[model samples]
Target: MSYSHLLLALSVVFVWGTNFVVIRWGLDGLPPFLFATLRFAFSALPWLLFIRRPAVPWQKLAAFGMLLGVGQFALLFLAMRADISPGLASLVIQVQVFFTIGLSLLTLGERVRGYQLAGLALAVAGLAVIATHLDATLTVKGLALVLAAAFFWACANMVVKTVGRVDMLGFMVWTSLFAVPPLFALSWWLEGPQAMASGVMHASVGVWACVLWQAIGNTLFGYGVWNWLLARHPAATITPMALLVPVFGMGASALSLGEPLPLWKLAAGALVLCGLVVIVVWPRLRTALLRTNA
Candidate 1:
């Protein structure tokens, strides 16, 4: 990637990394489901009117919304609500890589390469280390739900792979469109109508800022830059920078939320990042170096 594109990619990751902290703040004023409802609701409007809808099947788009939006965010929001710190949530969600690889193997009959298996082992060890401390800070239920969210995210990626080419921005808009009603219904069902209503009515300006930032900053601009970079560069080149997301998340949470960074947690995060590098960056580097030698 060129310097400019690299910078753009890093900027997108930073926005996404900080997003967990924003979600925690938003949940203070909005129920987890309600916050998700607002996130998709705001993301779909005005801009959705301008973005042309992609030609992918409506069913595929709907599934994408269910998996990535409702499924992922609901679980993630609840995970944070259970006292999982933002930085830790960010790191744990990287398990999506293992889930994606596993799903691809099962659904597509893809072979599990040695490198991927090694990465998976390291990733699992990293998660186990985090798991050792979960009872003290975050609940087991919360950790399990976050893992489920990561699984759904992986499933959503598979849906994207099946859909082939699309207008990423429009797909995102329409996915949010698909997510709104169900999320609101879930807000009422799970969070209770009265509680959700009270949360909505009593929400502070800071809450609104968090919601809008999530809609515009994290979802819109984040995906916009990501899709742009993907269009210009190979996915291999563009994606590895996202490994920095947890690094940013850890630092930002420490600075802003006063989240304590224990050495064990940091070590786990480093292991996770290293595993990601092994899976995502190593193959490309090997190929390049081999070409150079030849």
Candidate 2:
């Protein structure tokens, strides 16, 4: 990745990492599925009027949107509602990194070489530290749902990769159109009318602001650039950056949510950083080493 696109990828993950806290706050005043519905509504509408549809096929775009929006956020939000810690949720979702690599290899015949695989192993070990040190907030039900969300996220990565390059902003906005109906449909079935209505009526200003940020900052900018990067680089290279999410999520949680920054989490963050360094630098290092020997 170029320096500029690397910066863009970092920005995307930062917004996404902080978004866990935002989702927690939003869910406090809104039901999971309904909040998810409103999130897409705010993300997609109005802009839909301004931006032209992307050149991708209708079915492909719709499938990508549903997976990206519903398969990811709806299940994720519901898991959080089931009492998964925001920090843990962020960490566990990095399972999508492995899922992406595996699916990319199977579907696209992409190869994961020495440094990438090694870095991935280190990152998974970092996650294992956090997982083994789980607190009361970690539940089997929530973990299962989040892993499911991660799988859909990995599949959605392939969708964007398969579509290749196009208008990323327009594509995000358009895919969101397909996502909204299903979210509302599912919300109605899952979150009862009375429960959903009551939650909306009692929503606080903090919740409203969080929802707006989640929509504009997280959805528009984060997902837009993420898709752009996946289109620009190989999936294996682009996906490793997600390991940074739990690091950022843990820090954000400590600051905003009063979650303790345990030593193990800090150590895990360091391991993740080392893993990212290997992913970023190993290619150039190997090339230079070969050149010197020659």
RMSD of model 1 against the true structure = 3.2
Per-prediction TM-score: 0.84, 0.97
Tens-place lDDT per residue, model 1, 235-285, is: 334444565677778778888899877898788778766766676666778
Structure candidate 2, residue pairs in collision: none
Clashing pairs in 1: none
Where does candidate 2 stray beyond 4 Å?
A: 290-294
- lDDT of model 2, residue 275: 90
Q: How close is candidate 1 to the true structure, as a TM-score?
A: 0.84
Q: Stretches of candidate 1 above 4 Å error? A: 1-10, 116-125, 223-244
Find the candidate with the highest lDDT and give its number.
2
